[model samples]
Target chain A: MAEYKGVMTYCEIAEGSLPSISREVAGFGRKLADDLGEELCAVLVGSDVGNLAQDAIGLGADTVYVVDDPLLKEYQTDAYLSVMEKVVRKMMPRILILGQTSVGRDLAPMLAFRLDTTATLDCVGLAIDPGTKLLLQTKPVFGGNAQATFTSDFCPQIVTVRDKLMPPPEPDASKQGEVITLDAGLDPAAIRASLLKRVTENEGGVRLEDASIIVSGGRGIGSAEGFDQLQELAALLKGAVGASRPACDNRWLAPNRQVGITGKIVNPDLYIAIALSGSIQHLSGCAQSKSIIAINKDPEAPIFNYADFGVVGDWKKVLPAFRDKLKELLPG
Target chain B: MRIIVCIKQVPDPQASSSGTKVDPEAMRVIVPQGTPPVMSPYDENALEAAIRIKDAHGARVTVISAGRNLAKPVLRKSLASGADELVLLEDAAFEKLDSYATAHLLVAAIREIGEYDLILCGRQAADTDAGQVGSGIAEILKIPCITAASKVELSDGKVLVERVVSDGFEVIEAPMPALVTASSEIGDLRYPKLKDLQAAQKMPITVRGAQALGIDAAGLKRVNLVRLAEPPRRKTECRIIGGETPEEAGANLALKVKEAKLL
Candidate 1:
């Protein structure tokens, strides 16, 4: 039998707490580590974040690396990557995993370049091959038309798993693990870029990627003015508004509201695609939605194949009726 | 100043899957025959940025491409668009090169071309969407790289770039002879003019082999194929239940909203 090294999961911080994606990665990482007969280690870098370190251990990490630094309070790619590079060089783990969030997307490629390694981003699945001990990374490819599995015969195989790929870890507080503290070694001069200001979207609801219910519009929504109806419908459902590439391309909505390969990947519990013809790029983003509702006048629209239910009619006429029915079924 | 723009040709985004599996033996992806190819969207941005820089800084732009012989047409397209010269890095050796190896080959080729004030590439190739090529090139060349750049300006022998960051943006200034990956907003792409298109038809294209780049063709190996599976199917469950009239439907929708626990 071949011996296996441990797995290092980058426990991401969000909303001043451990993001749900971190627990999901930890749960999956724990299973992989257990199968390999190795421990799961979690790494956390933040300012005075020792208290949050235990949650990672309770989730699944057998050991937690805590780098408490005042400079690490906010996410600065250069600073974080610098510390991560130092930590990775010291630990030399077999596999390194992170959540495929915006931060992860920004850091993974840079880190890979720094480490002189290759990383597969937005991975949906991961495992270890028993014979070669290679970490098998699977991710959507070619604008979600296919899934590609990749492996590197190199050390510290890295991947970033998308959110909701795995169930959140069930906490086991009784299972205690060791927590080691380290200084992140962050120097102000090391920071090359300075944050000017953060401009968040003012009308906030659930983020499309993380939302359970999503209502989307497409070119068939007709005009930018038509989006208000979709917004009204989305508000009625307490769901978020998403747009097909055409809608975004037409500037009917913000780029962040676009759902497709170039936009945001969403897997909502219920996805309502309005007046969408279902272009592959648009479908790629919402294909993972638990249940898809496509409302279009064209019955032959490509989106029908991917949708769970279809309503062939004018969206301007159909959406309000559908919204009312949904409201009828689940009244506030 | 000399600027090098790395360009790649990809299938139209609207086209069906032409991606094959990792296992060459069991490859099942049907490469669509007679599919129209386009300059990768990101590469278009790269080309536009290169043209803009050339117009402002009086630099000569060289278009570089790596692919099979079939990529000649794609290379010519770049030349027609405004590039001063074209170099095609073609060989069986580059057939299976991944991002890392591809970057190495490109760096070697660039080194052979001698000094350059700047290198420009798309933030990512549309087909693979790996987004590692530019960064990998920067690493190999040991130059500062700015990725996801929405805006770029040259002043005082330095490149000032606005890199897209989460929440907002950040400005980074690097010295000349830097590599910058361009984002879509860099500039609007221009179509090839009649005169340029006519000239492009007569333009001489230079082709280089992998051996010339110091990479052993046999060393380019694909380790594993992640499976190529169809996208998950989505089922639309849309049903219409309200609206005696359009106005009635809106009122009913309001009532339904209250009933649905969503209001």
Candidate 2:
């Protein structure tokens, strides 16, 4: 293994701009570097991505590594992983931190396999041991019913932090770091997969992860017709519609709209749990929400504890009134 | 063309847990029996994708699964859904293998089945939700893997697939003999007809042991799991806004939301 003694953070760039998760990872990496008394180096791989390297330095990276190649304009798992593997082999950092975005999810596992190491994914917390210099990673397990803490006995500890797990870094204009441009060894034929086209959805609504107001439902919504009421409420409140695991299981909503540890972790300003008995898996994902509202017929439901507001009446009667009240309270 | 789809039977997501105690002798956890075993929801998507491919390309699709004898019911469901053949990798020792060993065992079974043009699997299993087996199998077999595939189209000599990314999707094109993990959006699955179910009962199913696949079940190791326990019960203190009418309850809830600063 290549031997470089520093913490390396993999910064993801999209549309020639840095993603928010990258800064969060950089902040966490800075903390880890401080604890280890080592420099934090940032690695950026993409086409025409050099302009974003300065943002990484502003986020607390002391050094930035850039692999700018035309072949990397689109992410192919094989080509991207090959460049990452080459960089890691050349500069063997003590720890590798990646943002648990889609790219991170695909690349981290492949990189770990190539490096013959283990990668802890979707970590919600991170800490470094001063004496041992080991990275302690914490993540929810068993569909969020439990949390597990793990550490690697091997070198080059790798962890992927879930999005929004850490606060984004505060920028300091006065801080300037060195930028090193490296050649990305690219072989087009080596990339088994090639991109043909990209289709993006146009519908606009609150993104589940970043939404401030989330109005959610569960299996008790009864039918597809019930979703119309939930959607109407979400629209009236300028919020997003989320579903519990049971709702997703019943195909009441798309899996992408599901909220839970296994689904999406949401920290909304107001979380409305409608016709849903809160399960542990669902609670773990929404526990960080500022306020929770439970609307269920069963007065003894588990969601009441997490909910700041509770409505014991049936949703059919409760939701319409609630929607009208919100309209009166905040006219749009 | 022959396509192989590896599936697993897991507890239904909605099933209540079987009351298995973390410390059974000590009376720790009472996880009631979870829902009955069924073809994993994700795997059903994979199976549906495979069936679509067969219908469009006239390909032979084989459904392969690993589990206890109780899994026969679940395996029959796959057969009823239009799989041309069924193979069950069964053994008492196969029950406890982790994802790594599971991948190895599946690879051995695939090798025993001879050459195949393509392989498909669910992105992850519902029970463990590991999302590792498909990738691990691809790694072991040294083949290209496209995961979380939202769309797949085959033409000429290449297979085109769109894998879901965080911000967007990354479209990938791979040659035959590639592996893909189906996402939920692959297609909507159809329920089996009565005729299909009856025909599935007459379909031949080949059951094999781990030894037949050249995997030493004894070598499999459990990395962790001191015990299993039920998740802690959530405590709820219901604050019933006692009101004679729904509007009064709505007002009371509005007050609570304002006090909580949820507005």
Candidate 3:
């Protein structure tokens, strides 16, 4: 029997340096490695991503494995999965951590299937059981209406975590680790799907993920035109404009601005929810906001339960007055 | 072209925040009786995407659902929405299946169907939200799978899929006999006409079990669901800013927000 040992995090990179998700998962993996009293290993894959090995060490990885190859440049299902399989097979880490982003979501499960182990997706909470040393994976289910904890008696327990749930570890340049470069023996014939073109919808404004404050509207905002008012309010506060799923589905806002379980998870300092009844799925996205303010006519709207301050009224009458009051309160 | 769309019947995901209850003892959600189950939202998009392809290229779209006891009224909607056939893979073991097991069953069923050009599934079920089965099936069958597809077109012996990514979308092309997972952005399931609705209800549904599908239910490893519970509630003492009129209330709310110094 191959005795799986230590924690391994699959590091993701965009442009050149590691993305925040890579750091976040590394931080999370660091905690697990500590609990298990084992080495934390990070795998850096992609074209010329070897420079990030020390960075991963600073994020708490004791050993960083670099598989820098041109064939592994962009995330193709087969290329990345094949790379991950070789890494997992070679190292045989007891635990594997991945971000619930585009690449991880696609790769983790397939890798799990190939390895004959189970992979838990979108896990918001994870812990190592002190008694038997099993990974307890906690994740939301039933449209975020409820959460479930799961465990499997399998080696290399795999998990993909939702974003923004954990902060990245503080970087310490003093930290050092061993970097092992592996040959990515990938075959071009193994690449099944090909990326033709990429289209980026650049909504020129503060990205919801990086925003300190978010002014979000919902179905009650009515139409596409109503978002302009939300945008104005967001601009006044130097924040970003976000929307509930309904608003996005109605084409009133782009899907990227959606804050919910299936959408982007945000942790803005202040979340202003307008004309939106808070659903569990939506709250799963923005509940980490430092403070929430809700405005809706229905006093019983669930948003109030999570709001620090709330106003009961029609947004049509209130928004204009809000603009006026804020305009008077602050300077451009 | 033959298309297979996988759908799951779940407790209404569109239900209000308070519509669900978790039975921790059973580690399952207790769906209230009399509240009919609806097709998971993304599966509807998957069906709609298939129908769009069917309308354009004249392909046969078959809807396959694997569950314990599915609602026919709900399953019929796929047909009413334009699926040409309905196949249900049902067994007691079908309930609360882990992604791997579900994928195992689906791959078996798809094999039984024999020939297929494309396999379409919802990005993830509105229930588990695991989003793994599609990728698993593709892997087990060794086929290319594109997930979170917003737009799919069959063009010149290839499947062109506009997949939803974090920053934007990516146009991916794969050869025939591929799989694609539809995201909600593809568009909601279309409402069927009265004639189509009637025809769908009368449509014959093929039902099979684990034994029939050649799946040894007792042999698979099931991920133990330890417990089900409500997320820890954030108890916020809400201060309702009030005034005589809506405008006055808005002004008061603005002042209160500043006082809070949230940003």
lDDT of 1 by residue, A199-285 (tens): 454257667766788889998987888999888878877788989866765667765677776567777877888898887667777
Candidate whose DockQ is highest? 3
TM-score of A-chain in each prediction?
0.92, 0.93, 0.96
Off by over 4 Å in 3: none
Predicted model with the maximum lDDT: 3
Task: Tell me what TM-score chain B of candidate 2 gets against the true chain B.
Answer: 0.87
TM-score, model 1 to reference? 0.87
If you assessed candidate 3 against the hidden native complex, which CAPRI class would it receive? medium
State the lDDT of candidate 2 residue by residue for B1-263, as single tens digits: 88899999876654533223345344233234645778877788888888888889888998888865646866798888889899999988787565556777888889888888789998777666556677777777878888888777788977888776543456788988888888766765679998998889888899989777778754653233333334454354446664577666766677666665678
Q: What is the DockQ of each candidate?
A: 0.36, 0.31, 0.77
Q: If chain B of candidate 3 is superposed on the true chain B, what is its TM-score?
A: 0.95
Weakest 10 consecutive residues of candidate 1 chain A by summed lDDT: A193-202
Name the runs in model 1 displaced over 4 angstroms.
A1-4, A187-190, A193-197, A320-332, B17-25, B56-58, B153-177, B185-188, B217-223, B231-263
Candidate 2: DockQ?
Answer: 0.31
Instruction: Please rank every candidate by DockQ, starting with the best.
Output: 3, 1, 2
**Which docking category, incorrect, acceptable, medium or high, applies to candidate 2?**
acceptable
Candidate 3 lDDT by residue in tens digits, B154-241: 8899999998877778999999799999988899888999999998999998999988988964467458888799777778989999
Q: Give me the displacement of residue B95 in model 1, in angstroms.
A: 0.7
Q: What tens-digit string does per-residue lDDT give for candidate 2 at A1-332?
A: 33648899999887778878888899999998998888999999999999888888999999999999999987778888889988988888989999877777777766765675657677777888567567777665545544555666555777788876656978876788999999997888878866777655313777777678998998789877898898898888788888886676566776567777556778887888999888766887787787788888888776887776788878888878777777777746
lDDT by residue (A1-332, candidate 3, tens digit) is: 24999999988887789888889999889999999999999999999788889998998999999998998778888888888999999999999999998888888988998898989999989999999798999999887878999998887899998888878888999998899999989998888888888887748889888899999999999999999999988988999998898888888988878899888899888999999999888988888888999999999999999999989999999888877897887655
Interface RMSD for candidate 1 relative to the native interface? 4.7
